[model samples]
Target: MLELRPNCECCGRDLPPASVEAMICTFECTFCADCVAGPLGGVRPNCGGEFVRRPVRPAAALARHPASTVRVFNPAGCGQAEAAR
Candidate 1:
């Protein structure tokens, strides 16, 4: 199942379960469309794959499937190198 990440990986924008702005790579690396298309504070995740939209979690089912708190963004300064390029 999709992690339904709570925020945009690149911008830290809050992405509630119903957000359509959340996009994910095959590896489940999440980012906003702006970050996917534009320079995200200088990081383009090196996921080595393309991104797809994250499926929304049914609100009522959340209790059965708790959300993951694992946040996956580029490692701090390293992202800038991607943006600089």
Candidate 2:
């Protein structure tokens, strides 16, 4: 199951469970669309992998399997990735 992380790892933007803006790499590193398209340039910093739009869990299913509450903000990593780009 997808963790459906609650925020963008780079910019700290909120991404709720049903957010269409959520993107995730294979390792489930989550980021907002703005971060991916702008600073991060569609590449995941940690794993150097591509991102895909995160699938939204249905309302009823989300209730049964709650989305993650953890926020994995990493501004430094984002800066590093941008610099490397």
Candidate 3:
């Protein structure tokens, strides 16, 4: 199951369970559309993998599964993410 991470790793933007603006990689590395499209350039910096839109977990399902609350913000921001990876 998808972890449905709660925020963008780069910009720290909120991305709720049903957010259409969320993107993720194979490792469930979550990011906002802006971060993926702009700074990260549609690739996951850590994995060097292409990103896909994160699916919204249905509200009813979320009650049982629960989206993750852990926030993974990049202190150095998105610009340095590629090199850091």
- Return the top candidate by lDDT: 2
Per candidate, the number of residue pairs that clash is 0, 0, 0
* lDDT (Cα, tens digit) per residue for candidate 3, span 1-85: 9999999998899999999999999999899999888878777766788899999888889999999998888846577545554
Task: Please provide, for model 2 over 1-85, each residue's C-alpha lDDT reduced to its tens digit, 9 standing for 90 to 100.
Answer: 9999999998899999999999999999999999899888778877889999999999999999999998898888886567776
lDDT of each: 0.67, 0.90, 0.86
In model 1, which runs have C-alpha deviations exceeding 4 angstroms? 40-44, 75-85
Residue ranges of candidate 3 with Cα displaced over 4 Å = 75-77, 80-85
In angstroms, the error of model 3 at 12 is: 0.5
Report the lDDT tens digits of candidate 1 across residue range 1-85: 7777777766777777777888777777677777766664323346446667778787788778866777765536236536655
In terms of TM-score, the best-performing candidate is 2
* Model 3 whole-model lDDT (C-alpha atoms): 0.86
